[model samples]
Target: MPSLHEFATWEPLLRLLRTGNAGNLAVPGGHVAGQISHYGWSLPLQRRIPRPGQAAQVEDVQDEFDAVQRVQGALADIGADTISFTAEISPTGRSVLHLISPGPAVEPGIGGPHPGSLILVEDSVPEPWRRLPDPVPGAVPAPSVDLASLERTLRERVPGAVGATEAEIAATEARLGVALPDELKVLYRVTRARWEDWGEDHAVAERVFTAVGCELFPLDDLYIADASSRPCPWRFGAREAVVTPPDAAVQGLVGSPGWIAFGDNGGGDRIAVDLTPGPRGHTGQIIMLSHEDNIGAGLLADSLSQLVLEGRGPGRRGRHGDGPPAVARVNIRSLDSVRAAAHAGLEVLSLGVWEGAPFSLAPVTGLPRLRTLTAYPGTLADPMEIAELTVLEFLELGPEDWRVLVDAGAVPRGLSAAAIEVHGSRHPLQVVALANELLTLWDRPPITRTIVEGHLEPGV
Candidate 1:
């Protein structure tokens, strides 16, 4: 139970967050342990709680896998390019130690360019907003705001938004020929004039929801995908799909969803509303679509306000940091961060934006247990050290000596899979030979050889 002071500035990220415990489907441990969730809390960072004499309970690979997938689902709701979650339980609730990533989801193929915005209001801009146009002597301050109109606009017009002027908002509604739901005006003034704009003063009033047993959390954050960016691969089961570009067909797909894009999960998906309603949806009704859910572009939420209020529902409080730090991705230049992650028991490492400089696998060998490594081979001065890991199951890159890592006995005996890319090299036979050896080790079929015009026939 550490004090509030012990946390980073992201503290407001969890403020007023409701917490509780629920009995979930029992995990393999055969214990119906209490499930902890936060209705208004989420962050990304790996954290550890000091257990003076107790053994540290680390979650296994499956648990990490499940958690990551669940986070992926949530992120898509916000149209974000990344996600951050915490697990370390502190006095107030869960205290995270290492999670702080907003990167794309890790999959077989590359993640797309995350082109969206993420702004947390309450935390960044506290109540009594910065430019509170001073209160007048008699008339109620800004009571010109019409509640019923605002609420109606939130429910029927958009998924919910604010921080802009009435005139600006009107113009957008007029242009789109679709009036926005009232919830936005009721929350904060629209930020700008365009349909997707948020009023410059994005903060909400304090104690504004005292009437409700639980306060209403506004839809303060916004993330609209920019079509100019490229798309990423979205994997669901064995199939893969690419989301539509901004200017392509199906007006409600990725970059060009006719309605306002309010959410993204960093994976290739978004929750959007239609300004130009079509056969698939009506104006203001929400829908979600991505490369994976191409066929599921139907009505999602009724209005912007409902989406936020319902989406912000409360959950259990405490989370145990029993899972190992599964993925640690650091910039190649931040060797210190890499070293720090290894020291903290990171199991999977993804490093670099490599240059032609020499790099060594030395710093990572210090990790008592590292199972997977993803890095660029061009930077490695000595990838030969990879042969040393007893538990290495996957090597993301081909070694510097790819031509003979296996025949030379440099590939670790435990390494089962590696993406060996020898696109235009002189010796393709050596790579085929190594591939055959690794396949044999895994008890899988070997490569089917094809003959060169004047070389030995196929496998001959």
Candidate 2:
């Protein structure tokens, strides 16, 4: 197996990059950048156009595919998650490559050539994820709940279904460290949903799904859908807020310990019995934790009984009101200026690419709830103003902006996590230098860089 640091591992890919982006490489300060992992790669090579009346295929870019697959094989052999590279080639074809390994604390950038993230505080999570559901003192099952009707419906639909034994139910309760809701216990009692019980028949499984109104998990697979179960990167997760309106039927939380995941919605969403309800909600209400969202669950049904019997609940309940937006993005296409996005409720402030003068952060300096701030390179008029945001927990800035904060010893100590936003063809080693500087302030592990010096022939 070729090592990831070997010139042979990256030679083919570098040749392809040089060949495809010849014009870009010939110019002054011109370079090409991309990322690769064991799974796949993000290269800037252009794809060949398909012939008239023909569809494009992998064969259209077979050379690029094969080249990348070779590097991917090396990555797999070396057990490396991901690596980013910056290649600069002269008009005569001489090239210098810089291979950057993002060490342990940083998360790989998504879908592009990014420097990845710098995790400042280890094992630290966002504020919303830390929030637990507010206790509902007098919560009880909804009036529509009918245990007898629900049992009868299940028995009628899945007539020959095998039910769970009392011993099996008790074992599940013990494993979960919480008692099963009465309606849920009744559900498994009618049909244990074991594949072995149905002799691994697909039709029987489908029948159970239809009768149960979801793809039911076996008794042993039941789990608490707590916040920890759904993990999100600090950069994006810190921007979310847990907001449960006064009239909300389900508490808007990252995840609740009371959420007992019993089944799936067939679309990867978890269908759970929410033991923790909102102000106007029933104790054992049905809710759905969307796989795509990280914050809250959607109220699916008032109860498990209501769901199985009627095939639906009181429809989808609104999670947030039309209050002031919690997140704000300032860019050419977004809220033109920071002042327009400023309010007491603002939690996230992001400054994107700007063509005009650099903006000051003074507008939101003293915002009590502001915790996340990410600025695009050169967008900030004064990066030093960030020191005024004493409550920031997550901050992502371009390397230059971060330098301003670091040089003045004003890197917000309250930040639990931070990220370096790399734009264009900045060298990854420089990004790592800035990342290490930030990590050093928090006494966290520094990002290690592996410089694998290699040269490529003009076009191989």
TM-score of each: 0.31, 0.93
Candidate 2 structure quality by residue, lDDT tens digits, 1-460: 5678777777888888888888888878788888988777888887887889989987778888887888888777877888887878776656677777777777787766565667777888888989999998989899988999999999999998999999999999999999999999999999999999999999999999999889999998999998899999887897788888888999989898899999998889899999999998999999988888988888888989889987855337675777878888999998899999899989999899889999988889899999999999999999989989989999989888888889999888998889888876676567778888887888877666555556665446
RMSD of 2: 2.3
The number of the candidate with the highest TM-score is 2
Encode model 1's per-residue lDDT on 171-243: one tens digit a residue. 6566545555554444446322222343322232212222111223233333333332224322111011122
Where is model 2 more than 4 Å wrong at Cα?
90-95, 313-315, 332-337, 353-357, 455-459
| Full-model lDDT, candidate 1 | 0.39
Best by lDDT: 2
Q: How accurate locally, in lDDT, is each candidate? A: 0.39, 0.86
What TM-score quantifies how close candidate 1 is to the native fold? 0.31
Where does model 1 exceed 4 Å of error? Answer: 1-305, 308-341, 351-357, 366-369, 399-404, 408-410, 423-430, 451-460
